[model samples]
Target chain A: MYAFTYHRPDTVRQAAGLLARKDDAKIIAGGHTLLPTMKQRLASPGALVDLGGVPELKGIERKGRGLIIGAMMTHAEVAESAAVQEAIPGLAALAANIGDPHVRHRGTIGGSIANNDPAADYPAACIAMGAIIVTNKRKIPAEDFFQGMFGTALEEGEIVTKVAFGIPSRSAYAKFRNPASRYALVGVYVAKRGGEVRVAVTGAGASGVFRWTAAEEALKKRFAPKSLEGVKADPSGLNSDIHADAEYRAHLINVMARRAVEAALGK
Target chain B: MAAVSMTVNGKAVTADVEPRTLLVQFIRENLKLTGTHVGCDTSQCGACVVHVDGKAMKSCTLLAVQCNGASIVTIEGLAGADGTLHPMQAAFREHHGLQCGFCTPGMIMSAVDIVNRKGSDLDEHTIREELEGNICRCTGYHNIVRAVETGAKAMAGSAPVRQAAE
Candidate 1:
């Protein structure tokens, strides 16, 4: 890893100021993804603005009909948070299954979504739940926040502060994970809010996590597993790798979507 | 260079380290506590697992500077001051949980953490699931699972029982 100056800021304003001032400074929340990248020499920032010391960016609370999760809350904290569990059990489950126990203890939700790994689980939950990505600068809807694999709408010096997720009427996530890395091979998150239904797929999109509109439209008609009888995930833009071919991923997407719906319905 | 200070194994220690120095490097090189091993530099293997502020984390993945004020407990801290083994350590010895023993320190530390969070009454499935972070290359998981179960029970017995308030 390249040697870089490290700054531990006490507040979001100071952290953002450091990020804006440094030409090549990156925010370090949990440092799970960034540290590994640096270790491999894939990224070399001149400075690192550590957000671990920022008090404003740490918490999980329910606001009205949604939950406001601080950017610095670790996966373990989220998974164990009573507020998160009561508000969105699916999200809590997703947090519990990320990587392993050790990883969850240190990895934060903000880092996971900001990195925007194609196979990450949080993106699916955020998009399916219609979450709002709150940054120091502004708020971006989940649908518009994620651009593609390892990409987001975040501008330079913008730091994610919190994520607000609406309490879905019913929601559940089902994942087929890669045994080695525990990353999603093909994961699906299903959510229903009144008359609207959203189905998000991760680890299958060639570009990144995407909503399966056909499945969503079908489920909106009838919120049941049978509602997705003929709906299918098109293999055209799905990921194809040694772990799973595009066709296989497509099939798994449909299967996982059905399972997610079943789980949401307590079937 | 950054000056980092933290309590390791109940002792306060301070050192000057590079910003990129991993916590494992500080624990092993600067502090000269070599029980914590780094099997995989990447965060996959849990060989370097240690408790920071009372939670198990992979030391290799954490920068020493990040743990500047945090209290850390490594494998060397698990036993009593008089050399009494922690229940989990004793259980591993009785159950023969390790073969090569390369992963034993991490496995034991993670086991203690599991017991702390999940309670002493653990099922076989839960033990296996919780052991996801620590990988024993020997694949000696059966005995390790047994050891965790027994160790959890032993830990419960060793805890000071509180008297009921009148």
Candidate 2:
């Protein structure tokens, strides 16, 4: 990686101040993606404000009707938390399946959403479950938080503090992962809560994580996998890469959506 | 340059390193612990896996400066002062888990953590799933999985399980 100064701040204000004061500073949450990109010269910030030292961004607990997950909490913490498993087992299962054990140990929920990688699982779960992204500045709804591929509504020096996800009445996530990196080739998250049905598709979106309104509306009419049998998702805006073509990805989205609905109903 | 201090194994040490220096580089170059190998420059390989505050993490992916004041354990620290190997280490040898041995350190570190979390009740499928981070090209993971299973039981029988407090 290009040479850079590292600053470990104990609080969000300190971290934000470091970012504001530096010429070119980036927030280092897990460093799983940032460090590798820097090493390859794809990204080179003059300084890094490490969030690992901030204690405020590290935990998971039940608050009211949802689970309040500290932004810095690793995937392992979410997967293993009895509270998370009890309140939202589907979300916990998604966390457990991300990358491998080592990656999960280092990667954080806040970083995952903040980075907004096209194939990340958290965005799907966030959008499907109606999660709230609580940053140092303001709380943004999941739909408003994700703007596009590798993009979010976060501004410069804005730090995500935590994410609050309401416990869905029923939810399940199914992903066909690329075997090599274990990232979703095409993943679907199905959620049914309070007479509202929402389906979010990740990894296959050209515009990043998006809600499949057609399938969601269909499922809303009848909560069953067969409800989406006739609903063919358009392949127009799906991602096409070496792993899978746009047509195949669009086809898999339908299959995954059906399976997600089945899984959620079974739960 | 930055000054980082941490407990490695049972020893407290300090070093002045650039913020860009990786933890694997600090452990291998600064401390001369060569057991931790760097198979992939990227974080894809688990060869640089080490226990940071009792949790397995890719040392290659983390900057040395990020590990300040943390307790780290490398493959070299798995044995007793009397030269007795950790049960996981012992099981690897008995099960013939290594051939090239490039991935052994990471495999052993990840194996111990798996057992630490799952205990002796780990089944074949769970062992395979948990070992996903570690890649053993030589043995095709047949023996590595066996070693982890045998090691988990041996570790559970021998001492108080080290829970991952992190």
Candidate 3:
């Protein structure tokens, strides 16, 4: 890893100030992705603004009909949180399945969504549940927050503070993970709230995590796995790699989506 | 260079290190406690697992500077001061959990953490699932799973195990 200056800021204001002051300074929450990237020389920022010291960016609480999770809450914390378990059990299950125990202990929800990896689980959950990505400067809706793989609507010196997720009537996530890295080979998240239903797919999008509108439309008609029997995900823009070809990914998307719906229904 | 201060095992230690210096480097190089091995520095392999602030974390993935004011416990600190092995360590020896022993330290640390979080009565499936982060290429994980189950039971029978020095 390249040698760089590290600044540990105690507050969001101080963190933003440090980012503005330092050239090419990157925010380090859990440092799971950024640290590995730096170790491989894929990224070399001149300075790192460590957010681990900021107490403001931590905690998980239920507010009204939604859940407000602080950005710095670790994956382990989210998985073990009684609030998350009672409010949104599927979200807790997703958190529990990320990376592994050791990685979960250090990796945070804020870091995961901010990185916006194409294969990440949080993106699918956010988009499916219509979450709100709250940053120090503004609050961006989940649909507008993610741009593409490794991209977000975050501006320079912007730091994510928390994410607000509305508790859906029913929701669940299913993923076929790469055995080696445990990243999603093809993952689907299904959420249904009132008359609206959203189905989000991750790890198989050429562009990035995207909503499967056809499946969503079919499910809107009938919120059941059988409703998706004839629905198909077009293989055109899906990711193709050694792990799975575009056709296989498209096929798995249908299968995983059905599985997610089944899980949400406790079938 | 950055000056970092933290509690390792039972002692409070201070060191000057590069900003990029990993927590494993500090534990092994500066502190001269070499029990925590760095099998895969990229964080895929869990040979460098250690307890930081009462939780098992990948030391190699953490910058030493980030651990300032944190409490850390390596494999060397798991046993009693008089040299009695930790229940998990003893279980591993009895169950022959290691072949090359390269991944034993991390496996043991992770096992203790599992018991701490999930309780002592662990099933085989739960143990296998919880061992996801720590990879062992030897013993086919059969013996390791057995050791974890036995160790967890032993931990339940024993007094609340003291983690690191206060």
**DockQ for all models, in order?**
0.83, 0.83, 0.88
Clashing pairs in 3: none
Model 2: per-residue Cα lDDT at residue A156 = 91
Pitting candidate 1 against candidate 2, the one with the higher DockQ is 2
| Model 1 docking tier (incorrect/acceptable/medium/high) | high
- Residue-level lDDT of model 2, residues B1-166, one tens digit each, is 9999999998999999999999999999999999999988688879999999999999999999999999999999988776778889999999988889999999999999887787887999999999888877675598888988999888886554333211
Best by lDDT: 3
Model 1, which residues run further than 4 Å from truth? B160-166
lDDT of 2 by residue, A166-264 (tens): 889889999999988889999999999989999999999998999999999999999999999979889999988899999999899999999998888
In terms of TM-score, how similar is model 3 to the real structure?
A: 0.98
- Please report, as a residue range, the 10-residue window in candidate 2 chain A with the lowest summed lDDT: A258-267
Q: Candidate order by DockQ, highest to lowest?
A: 3, 2, 1
Is candidate 2 or 3 superior in DockQ?
3
Residue B83's lDDT in candidate 3: 82
RMSD of each candidate? 2.6, 2.8, 1.9
Tell me the tens digit of each residue's lDDT in model 1 across B1-166.
9999999999999988999999999999999999999998899889999999999999999999999999999999988776778889999999999999999999999999999899999999999999999999999999999999999998898654211111
Please state the Cα-based DockQ of model 1 relative to the true two-chain complex: 0.83
- Native contacts kept, each candidate: 0.79, 0.88, 0.90
